[model samples]
Target: MRSDPLIAVEHVSREVTDSTGTLTILHDIDVALPARQSTAIVGASGSGKSTLLAIIAGLDRPTRGTVRLDGVDLFALDEDARAAVRAQRLGFVFQSFQLLGHLSALENVMLPLELLGRGDARARATEMLGRVGLGARLHHHPRTLSGGEQQRVALARAFVVEPQVLLADEPTGSLDHATGETVMALMFEMNREAGTTLLLVTHDRGIAARCDRQLHIEAGRLKPAA
Candidate 1:
């Protein structure tokens, strides 16, 4: 039998109000991200793909809806509780290679470990950097590394915590085709090794094709996969 979905997004919606009045970014979005599988969210820009990803990650609250991560109700939690859940269960990879400029690659990866107060933060960070083939560049800062290298550091950071789910948004958007391919390969390989579920948001059909399933969003609504 198949394992249960690790993420359940139920009737989610996101709206914003400004001078022009209310605008909806996501419309009653409902989907489940299955465990230990690669799933892609694909759509044109502003189609609410990223919004959906953020909500799943507990990075943003839906205007109306409930997101349950591992059967824990995320929306029911206070902000601090939600944040604690995020730190404990979710890992993120972003297009911009979100690393600290002031910190070395090793320090960057050690961040989550440090947050969890893992006593072996340095050792674990070092080992993860080696796994991503950045052992020699561990001391380098973001500005000193090539784009691909920086992205590798990001991958290291995301995997260091060994989270139950990985949330990635256009992780390859900032790199050239060749470099993106390398990083993506490493990402999938690590996910496999860790048995972590992958939920990716991207515009590249090729990348989506690599996923076990695809979620298509159009103008704030999700359509069944063709």
Candidate 2:
């Protein structure tokens, strides 16, 4: 594992069996994401972009292949260890903005830090919310916020811990162009500031173009963008 390569995915494949027989989602995917550099995984729906993100993030396991993050072999770790690694080294943003409707913005942002028993969880959450221009809305619940505001809250929550790698899956998929651009700008800015490696999953060409490198996936195969 290189110090600068925060994430390495080698010969990764994921398969599942349904009544229709075996279906392969990703095949022999190889990627090396360098620290502080932005990388995009672009593909159509069912092209396995989100699946790859999940495997790399340690949220899902591949039937075959290895994922190493910051010198830790994600699959080598047991369930609890993998969870710990994710807690300490990874941050994730999703297309759906998976926030708790019952929790306020501040509480949503504080969840990870509090789980880690960090003493500054509340202060850190408040600062992150403020950084995302949502300081005034910290007490607002998800249902009360607009789509863009909810996404901003998700962004705040993702960056609250300053993890080594940031994984975003269609982060701007729900916003209009202007709002999406603003959200992406904030993401890139925070990545730069924190020196976090960025691995983004998106269908938007504009977003892919802004990354340091682009990868294209089609029918379970991974290839460098043309």
Candidate 3:
């Protein structure tokens, strides 16, 4: 792993306006994550774990401070530049699987590579699907697959690009315990092989325990691990 921090969140906070007044979703937070390390953001629902993840991924801006990815201040870049950085360096997995229902598994996995203008999108996506144990289901659509299988497809899509950082939000939240376990195992195995920085938001302590470090959030305030 790299000695320098791959991701740095400094005094970050977020607030939004509601019907009555400003609602703060996150308080001042500071965190630095090393390259190739797996870290879990653990908290109850509405504690701003997802919000923090979004800020780090450059999908959302922080209200108070800056987020640095690979030593570049994310918020300093223009929107298009930030998006380009995200496209090239970050991969995301969500709880809902986020697969296009009409596209086949192979197509879904190939989309990222296509977006990045890779000429060998199909072949690369096929190899990724096979690696995720979905070789036989490449032609199947998301609706035709089981929850576990759908998540596998999502994983293939995220990992196909060989991103520098992988951000997953409740990746197994929609599956049964056994199936979730299997999916998570594959995810970690792939992360280890790729040596990508893994940061995930999860409510399951069991899952959090499997990561290298766990950071807790309570009512939008970040608390260091004990």
Candidate 4:
């Protein structure tokens, strides 16, 4: 069975003004990302891939057009309401691991569930950590763990929510090749098992190939069907 798209981007563009004047970061972009599938955005530096992802995740606004999440117009909502929708529907994993140095692996994973008032936060987080092979390191802080361990904890936190959408930005960029491969494999496995829609921005073609489809970008424009 085919599910309706979880996200729809329609003619979106972004521009920023600096001392050098206005710079166009993204041209008009349109795409539909179906639920429970993974799509990768690949491009060179300054290609606006991350910008597009941020816009889709409602972290950034477009100068033109709008994005819809599960048929709800993102820009149509007020900031707080949009934030609420984003928090409820989306999860993220980043190259930097983005974990708190002060929080242990289990605590970091439990934070999101706690934010949502889930009483089973500790139990769910513990299970997720075990799933990612981090059960023994549950009490280790990000600074105390290796890079791969931190990323695994990040993956656990991301999947713990079973979010409707997962957005990853260069998730392997900061790791060694061997560790990167392991993390990516685990991320795919988690995404698949949770039936979450994934939108990843990556520079590596191999990583892009892991996705269900690839959207190629060049000069701030998407190349059709890559």
lDDT of each: 0.93, 0.90, 0.95, 0.92
Top candidate (lDDT): 3
lDDT-better candidate, 2 vs 3: 3
Better of 2 and 4 by lDDT: 4
Candidate 2 residue-wise lDDT, 37-149, digit = tens: 88999888999999999999888999999998877789998999999988887888988899999999999999999989999999999999999999899999999998889
State model 4's lDDT: 0.92
What's each prediction's TM-score? 0.98, 0.95, 0.97, 0.97
Which tens-of-lDDT digit does each residue in 4-89 have in candidate 1?
67889999999999999999999999888778989999999999999999888788899999999888999889999988888888
lDDT of 3 by residue, 194-223 (tens): 999999999999999999999999999998
Question: Could you give candidate 4's per-residue lDDT for residues 29-118 as a string of tens digits?
Answer: 988888888999999988999899899988999999999998999999888988888778899999899998999999999999998889
Model 1: residue 102 alpha-carbon error in angstroms: 0.6
How does residue 63 of candidate 4 score in lDDT? 97
Which segments of model 3 are wrong by more than 4 Å? Answer: none
RMSD of each predicted structure: 1.0, 1.6, 1.1, 1.1
Instruction: State the local distance difference test value for candidate 1.
Output: 0.93
Error (Å) of candidate 4 at residue 111 is 0.4
Residue pairs whose backbone atoms clash in candidate 1: none
Model 2 has an lDDT value of 0.90
Superposition TM-score, candidate 1 onto the true structure = 0.98
In candidate 4, the residue pairs with backbone N, CA or C atoms under 3 Å apart (3 or more residues apart, or in different chains) clash, namely none
Ranking by lDDT: 3, 1, 4, 2
